[model samples]
Target chain A: MLLKPKTSILQKIYLPDIIIGLWITIKNFFFGKKVTIQYPEERRNYSSRLRGMHYIKTINGVENCTACMLCPTVCPAECIHIVAGERPDKEKYPISFEVDVLRCCFCGMCEEACPKDAIKLSNIYEMSMLKRSVYEKDFLLEQRGHK
Target chain B: MDFIDWIILGIKIGALLIALLSVAPVMSWVERRGSALMQNRLGPNRVGPFGLIQPIADAVKFMFKEDPVPGHVSKFYYVLAPLIAFIPALTTFSVIPFASSIEVMGRVVRFQVADLNVGFLYIFAIAALGIYGVVVAGWASNNKYSLLGSVRSSSQMISYELSMGLSVIGVIMIFSSVNLNDIVRDQGNVLFHLGQFAIPKWGIFVQPLGFLIFLITVFAETNRLPFDLPEGDSEIIAGYHLEYGSMKFAMFMMAEYINMATVSGLLATLYFGGWQMLPGMHTLLESFSLSGSLSGITYEWVRIVFEMFSFVIKVAFFMWFFVWVRWTLPRFRFDQLMGFGWKVMFPLSLVNILLTGIFIKVM
Candidate 1:
């Protein structure tokens, strides 16, 4: 459909319309409240259920992961590699647990699949790395989670 | 010229150069921070207090970065283009009076480098040469986008220059002088008086339509936003300077900002009262009895300082106006821009000149 531009003689003059624009900008410059957070000095709070970096939960210095295959089965990316082993104290434990961060889709299926609540998606979102990293079992445990 | 006159001339040139050179970096900082403030964001506030030293950091970064000249580009014009761009911008300021003359040791010193008898002509001539820089850069780059940008830029500038030159003819007629200093001095008298209220004879008050035409044309000639088809990032991908890098690119950026500053100064000088103190400023200065306490302080010197301050304020407002308009308005389509320049601006400026002539004769 073709439409004619809606312009009055005043607008056609251009000067008056431009002056109105100049007024609004000047008003904002002097009086408008800015919404900038100024990173490194101020930060926004994330919700409790916010999903970010991956972490393995621990209780009393013992890993809660029971080498449950449900998480790996549920994971769409198939990035989780867990090697289960029978130890002296524990009936079943993950001897070698690795998460290929490059491949992981960050869907948080592992957290929902864990029956023991051993795996979780933390709110610590600063996960930038210089190289492709595979999160080892040792690095996944401890109080590293922000949430 | 005598020995003292030569010395004074050298000092004037040096002072103007230093002032203009320093303003480029300061303008970069202002543009960034001012845009951020208007858009509800903080821009470059990490380097120093309110990011005051951000331009310095940017300069350092640009210095360390590797500059690569693309192999396909013509080597000679590529090297000369930035110099051509920069020199015109710097030289335009030589004729613009920053402040009225001050008496120092019984000698009169004007706050301008070289106030040519025909300063308006000199400025317009230098400005006309500025298009060559963009055209040369675009043609030498051997890129399709650059060539298109150059073509667009040259056409746009040429079209607007006609209206701009025509618009100023009204002011020239009213002032009866081509010298900028004389024009500025001519604006000092009262235009009209009704009872106690008086209107200072500013160009904006008398030749308002001409002023409007001149203002719009200046923005287009400077290749600013809403008319910035030459450097249309979305369309031409950095335009004429697409192949330029490091300091060569920096020089173009400097040229652009300096051009902006010079235009703003000219706007203030030509339309708003240039270096003329705001109304009642002299009375306000006289009301203060601080002069009696100081031994050698003269009221003339005090008034000159006030006038200089007023000039600075007007120029600064225009600078802010430039940045403000840039963020507010969207870019004009190439055809729309040309159409407006010829069809709208040209006829309007001609009408303005006609009205001014009739009014002058009748009055």
Candidate 2:
């Protein structure tokens, strides 16, 4: 159904409507609150559950991973790689752990698949880089994750 | 003219040219920032101090950029069009008085470049000539859109000029002078005393309808938004200046802003008491009491400075008003623009003239 807007004589003349339009703009110009965040100086807070860059969880200078290879098996992108090895203090540890960050889908499935809660996603979203790089185990152990 | 008179004329011309030229860059910045503010966004604040130097940076970029001449365009006329458009826009300011005359060294020095007896008429004539540049650019570019833009521009200007001229007829009737300075001086007279306060007989009070018509027509004359059909970006893709780039395009942009400033000055001079002190300025000047303290030459200088300051303030307000209106109203459709110009503004201005004539005859 088509609807026709009712028009008055004053509306037809248009001068009053123009004046009202101008008044609205002037009010916005003088009193309206600006919505710009001035990006470099300010940043917006995101939800804690946001899946961003990946990190490895460590407690008391030891990783929570038992080298169970669960994360690599569950990752949809097949980006994660791990090699289990025996260490002097631990029965099992990963000698090599790598995440091909460029292939990351950020699904958070690897975090869920890890039985020991060793692999996790953080809220640090600024992951831009000049060169493409894979996240190595040493770099991932920097404790950059908030959760 | 004597040697001193020649020197004074040279100074006036130089000052006016400098001020007019600077208005383009300054207004570009103001338009960007003002529109941004109106829309609740911060525009171009990354350059020097709220983007004050942004236009200068843009000018430098224009200067350094490659100015390619398209092979399809007519070479001579294409190069000549911007100059034609620009010179007339700059020249229209000569007859407009910035402030009243000051007696310097026993010889009167006016704040105008040339005080022509037919001042406003000179403006209309020169402004009409600016349309040639648009038409020539459109034709010379050898493009359909450019030609269409030029055609629209010429017709729009011609249609609106009639009403613009007719609207000011009321002002001329009330002020009884063609000279802008004389008209401004006449506007300073008190219309009536109401208790302790008196209202100055500005052109607006006497010819409200004329003022309204003139204000609307000035928008059309300057080819501003709601009347900017010539450069309707969505329609014709920048219209006449589509083929122009680098400094040539800059020249057209400069011509537009300068024309805006010139017409804004004209609007203030005709309607709002040009060079007359604003409402509270008289009391402010009285409180200073500089006339009693300062000597003859000094007092005259002070008075001239104050008047010039008032004129600048009025012109600035109108310039900002143009920007305000531009951001507020959407562009008019081509048909709506033409219809409004002929059917509405034309008849309204005619009625304004008839009413003014009757009022003058009765009084």
Candidate 3:
């Protein structure tokens, strides 16, 4: 694990970083202020270009997803899977679909590679779940968030 | 016997006042200066030539600042907290023996105030009392963060006090004296001279491990770097004194600095031979032109002055050292700090005591 020469006379078996860490503390204490910046008064700066949570675009309740299987192949983590069936118009559409977000690497390649532009990756990153199964959702309804 | 001694008493009182005042400001300056150097930055140089009168400016600002009491707090305890923090810090110095006594105007005047046999015990008791102020400050504030900080501080200090007391027991056995002067006197002994070098072997040499343990314990007790968990600025927001402002906040700080100075002085007296020059240096000084005995009153005055200088130099060096160490080390985390004190320091202290016993018997 060590980068230094093995036969070097001062090659210490134990790392002495603990003492160095202490010294660093001493340095910071003297150098920096307590910096109890009033939270409301002093807001941390965020870049304007930063993408946040996702939003879905819909026209009169019609959506673009179209049960595309192309997204499933493009996902690096193999998180996307879709089951398709014939609609009343005889056009094929997805009957069942699931995104195993637990396995998702979030590379966003699936959205970019979609040929029909039907799938889009959401900007949302604040997702949390107590159980892995909770992340394995059955549907993608936006406004009605999960309990 | 008459009018002049009355004048002399006034002069002594004036001197003591001056001494205390100078030490206070100088200690502040030293702390800031040492911190600056340690941090690789310039400290307080704007006012009065490298911030010499900074303490005066600070004192003035404190005096003029508006005092506030939150409606949720207990007025009595809030007001009392600062005093509790400040008093014990200054009081512990009363038993210190600075130097030897000499005859002045046909009367013997000791260099120190009353020396108590239980001097070290008195220090322990006084320092322990400081926790009460911190605890009460937290409880009276009605702030969750401050309350938690105060509780943590009182508990941490109380727990470490055991190891602190245990660590110093070896010194007690070695010198068998709680009176600081006696401790210094015992350490001044030289069994033999080594060629050109005289050996008045300091306590540090004989008990390096005890010295190390004592140093670590004192750092925790004084609430300084690495051990300053109570005042963890980031996580705790000024700890017990978070709710306090103006002069009250200033008082807590003043107490902490005074504790630093007090502990540093105690360290010097305990391990570094109080005011005495080290062994070879003592011999070298003896070899100088003034080698013979002196019986005159002038000689007595000269001796007193020199001894006082020795004590001052020793105490000042140790105070500087406290700042040096503060800048040289980092703070420990809550869990790590507790682990270090209880698991590491306490056990090592017991082992040190055993080793000291072995050394005493074998040596």
Candidate 4:
């Protein structure tokens, strides 16, 4: 059962109430500060820890990744594929690294799992692509993200 | 008519047509921008400076778009309906006086297009014809939703029009004239006698209850929000104009906005002081003119321009009010709308008329 509230004579005549409503709207229209941030010209600051685009951290001339297979092991989507090979300077380095971007959920687990802090998820969220993209080793190493 | 008179009339008609045509698209921009302002956001600021030219761009886009008629619909009524809707909306402005009469080129020129004795009735009768367009479009569409929308619109408009018509009776009774020009001229009189404290006899002051009723019914008649059951997108999926596209759709939109403009014009002319300014404003302007900033014929021209400007401002205020109300109120349920119209609005209008009658007799 529904209880209908008894309306007073003043309430039944809705003009006064409508006037009050109008007053509130007019006040807001003229005085209330808008919250819109125009995109392209303006951007919101994301946290440093935001799980965005994947990037391979580099220092000096060499990549930080030693290809321990930890990122691939921990990746929930199993998107990461690495083929470890020996180099002159490094005992283990990835000869090939691939990440199927569509399959990856950007959970930052691979970043967490990387012992060398090599595979970092940087604060670069715009990842729209015309076609399906798989991140190659050279492609992932580009300075495309804010750390 | 003489050659000069015909030329003057031609100029007036051309100016009026252009003015009426431009109001709809400008209102479209204002509605978008104003609603955005109320909701705390920027709307359409890219097309031009504050998106002023956005409506022009929109019209251009509508022109280029392909208009495909559905195979199932009746072709004749489908084509005719938009013209039917648009013509009446445009024509209703003919009877409305924008300002008091002024002398121009040695001839007295009234601001209105046609000063028929049955001015208000002409407005009502022309406005009433708009329902036919909606009904015809809906029926011809061969779509159930469109039919339902048209039915709802027709019934709502028909119902609300009774109260709307009745509300105007009070104004007519008070003014003792159906000619809108006379009604406006009458409004320039002092409202009441109170030892050096005279009020302007605005229709709003004289018939507050009638004004309220008229305001409400205008919203319903225009099929605006809180009374937009006919075109409720969520329920009826654009109602009567569901199958329409491109220029046809644009015509319907133009018709709706022009209806809004007409209502705003009427509201300003009837309740507000029409072209008449606030009590001291005209005297202030006259005093300023006497101070010798402008002299002779230029002064008359200045006054005429100022009066026209004031009329535009009054109409614009009511147009802004329409947008403000649209953004503020939620749509009403059909049953509740009908109930309110009959139960509340109808009886209240009668009481107002009765009281107005008694007041007129006593005084």
Alpha-carbon lDDT, every model: 0.88, 0.90, 0.72, 0.90
From the highest DockQ down, the ranking of the candidates is: 4, 1, 2, 3
What candidate 3 gets wrong by more than 4 Å, as runs, is A1-147, B1-18, B278-295
Query: Per-residue CA lDDT of candidate 4, range B150-223, in tens?
Result: 99999999889999999999999999999999999999898887898777899999899999999999999999
Model 3, position B18: C-alpha lDDT score: 58
Off by over 4 Å in 4: A144-147, B292-296
By lDDT, highest first, what's the ranking? 2, 4, 1, 3
Worst 10 residues of 4 chain B by lDDT: B275-284
Q: Could you give the DockQ of candidate 4?
A: 0.74
Q: Which stretches of candidate 2 lie over 4 Å from their true place?
A: A1-4, A58-105, A116-118, A133-138, B70-72, B140-145, B283-291
Residue B57, model 4, lDDT: 96
| Residue B151 in candidate 3, Cα distance off native in Å | 1.1
Alpha-carbon RMSD to native, per candidate: 2.0, 3.0, 14.2, 2.1
Q: What TM-scores result for chain A when each predicted structure is judged separately against the true chain A?
A: 0.92, 0.85, 0.55, 0.90
Q: How do the residues B1-363 of candidate 1 rate in per-residue lDDT, one tens digit apiece?
A: 789989999988887788788887898999999888788776888888999999999899889899888999999999899899989999998888888897888788888788799877888899888889999999999999999999999999989999999999999989998888998998888899979878888889889999989988999988889899999999999899998999889988888888888888888888897887787786688676464642344766777789888888998998887888998888999889989999999999999999999989988
Q: On residues B181-234, what C-alpha lDDT tens digit does candidate 2 reach at each position?
A: 999999899998989888899888898999999999889888898888889999
- lDDT by residue (tens digit), candidate 3, B153-194: 987897789888987898887888788878887777884578
Tens digits of per-residue lDDT, candidate 2, A1-147, equal: 999899999998889999999999899889988888898898887899999988899999899888999999989999999999998989999998999999989999999999898999999999988888799999888797689
**C-alpha TM-scores of all predictions:** 0.95, 0.89, 0.68, 0.94
Candidates 2 and 4 compared by lDDT, better number: 2
Give the candidate order by descending TM-score. 1, 4, 2, 3
Candidate 2 i-RMS: 0.6
**Which candidate gets the maximum lDDT versus the true structure?**
2
lDDT of 1 at A87: 90
- Where does the lowest 10-residue lDDT sum fall in candidate 1 chain A? A138-147
